[model samples]
Target chain A: MFLSFCDGNGSALGWAVLITVVLGVAGCAKNYVVLLPNDDGTTGKVAVAGREGVTLLEKGREGAAIGGPAGKTFMVSDEQIAEDFGAALAASPQKPVSYLLYFKAGTDVLTPESQADLPEILAEIQRRPAPDISVIGHTDTMGDAAENARLGLVRARSTAETISQLGGSIISPDRISIESHGEKNLRVSTPDNTDEPRNRRVEVTVR
Target chain B: MLAMRLLVLAGAFSLVVNVSSAEDAVIGYVKTVDGDAVVLVAGKATQAEPGTPLQRGNVLKTGKPGSMGVTLKDNTVMSLGPDTELVVDEYLYSPSDGDLKLGASMRRGSLNYISGVIAKLKPEGVSLKTPAGNIGIRGTHFLVTVEAKD
Candidate 1:
């Protein structure tokens, strides 16, 4: 009877230890929810109290800071999670890069250095899948606004033609668009009729 | 009875874990794509195109020569320049209820942002995160750029 009692006590102790471990794990892992708490608080700041730390949040604003352990579990508010926060966690689109190919004075011809950069730009466009191209022309303030506009378009058209010839594999005619900003949008701002080499260029946006 | 209680506790714990990691929700759609842009969500890359519904937690990445324009539900127009990485992070907007929150993070590249209803209603509610520091939106139109880290 004594041996049986000892065996029974040992089993009970083992069960208690298992239960404690499970309970402890749950306590440590309880996830906390973020509370916006105030709707009229757009001008007002809301405090997000989390295990990581407290973050003071304002309206029309977003951040990628840690609200919790993984820095991901931010919005679990009173059984109504802020789904928009999840979208914030998701990847947005990448930014587009542009290359400016300078042109010769009063002509649509590309400068030697700018011509050299054409292959590099083409390679950049070819690296992507079905890229879109925007060819915008600009000129120095040396000419009249109306004439500069026409010249810009001519420059853009010439660049487009070159891109078409060189970009056989990737450049579909429909994917390319040409525009002339002319002297209206100056790369280097100067007085009217001022000639600037930097401003006489074609800006190509390859995305 | 003890066994039943233990089982209940374990079940409850599992449920909490599942709820905390719920799937991301869609917030807006891609209005335009100039080149090669993609939205990275759940480890999968989705080509960004017109009418591509954007979700919270989506990471936007552009290729070497890519650009993307996005319109949010509240009419917030954002144009992203190439080689950019942006995350929506969090956005909560309900005008009638007066619950407005917008948050985003730009890891690299340039973003041209025009204020939407959220910013108009409460300018202080909008915040943008960058490598330099946090940007609090007071004006309606602005541009932000985060260059690539060496």
Candidate 2:
């Protein structure tokens, strides 16, 4: 009986030692940052400035403790990531989408093709929950700066009105914001008095 | 002459108000909420819901089972997991004037961040502060989890 008791105690100590080692290695630090690939499958770098030093993360799934010793990183497994960030990832909102609606030169009227694209914008607006949009108008450098500013505002306002009219009850009027970038923001850079068709457009971003 | 002077003074006052109000305009909106969350503006807590407008200096907090997502005017996307607290300390998005910035702080909890126009235009202007350290984003998607201090 004395020998059996001693054997049982030894086994228990071995199991405890194994469990402690596993836990120490697996749960080293709870505070850390992970780099994720962009929707396009391209990865970017992140610099974490910690107390000891800075660590740069460039590859997907590469992670480092926020309070780091620079250059120290580990690969986070998919299971661990899901357990840690499932809620936050699941709660991410839909990414915003932008559309460029071309306008007739010197007017707020949409081009024939742009007019047909209005339905698509309306569809997107209806698809989102509590959606908001911004209509920013841009003008070519063909006119005076002040005049272009006014024209840009006109285009933005008219485009917003069209979206509201088509969306009806799907979106509230207060949710649509209008701004005018005028000749300052040009899609295609050109000298003054140059007529660039691409520059004369309104950008609508649905979020 | 006295009436004209008073009118001028009133015009100046209104102009100042207009400029200040423009600065305090809504910078983003709460796009998604699950479970329980609140947005604290000027220290006053309001239950967060879809369409809730978020201004600068707002603190977003979530309960144990809560989650929230927000999309800023510049298209930056952020989501917070349960028991999380984040503050939008500063935001300046005026691309026409070449002014762009986004500064935020995460006191504790998990966050999912996706870069936006501001990051693309001015990469150095964006920073996320955590208790452990500061994160300098170079226009990418990332996840952060800050454990609560005992």
TM-score of 1: 0.42
lDDT string for model 2 (B1-150, tens) is 999999999999999998778658899999999998999988899999999999888899999999999999999999999999999888999998898999999999999999999999998999999987899999999999987775
Indicate which candidate wins on lDDT.
Answer: 2
RMSD of 2: 7.2
Per-residue alpha-carbon lDDT of candidate 2 for residues A77-172, written as tens digits (9 for 90 to 100): 788689889999999999999999999999999999999999999999888878999999999999799999999999999999999888889889
Q: Rate the local accuracy (lDDT) of all candidates.
A: 0.65, 0.89
Candidate 1: DockQ?
A: 0.03
Which lDDT tens digits does candidate 1 get at residues B1-150?
999999999999999886554434445667567677999987699898865767778898888678787766555667776778899888886653577878998887666665566887877788877664565654344344454555
Residue A175 accuracy (lDDT) in model 1: 63
Model 1, range A1-207, lDDT digits (tens) per residue?
221221224555566455547664232221122223222343333333333655554433322222232232222222222222222212233334579999989999999999999999899878754456678899999869999999999999999999999988677876676778889878789999997999999988765
lDDT of 1 at B141: 44
DockQ of every candidate: 0.03, 0.76
TM-score of chain A of 2: 0.87
The alpha-carbon lDDT assigned to residue A183 of candidate 1 equals 91
Clashes of 2: 0
User: Scoring only chain A, what TM-score does candidate 1 earn?
Assistant: 0.59
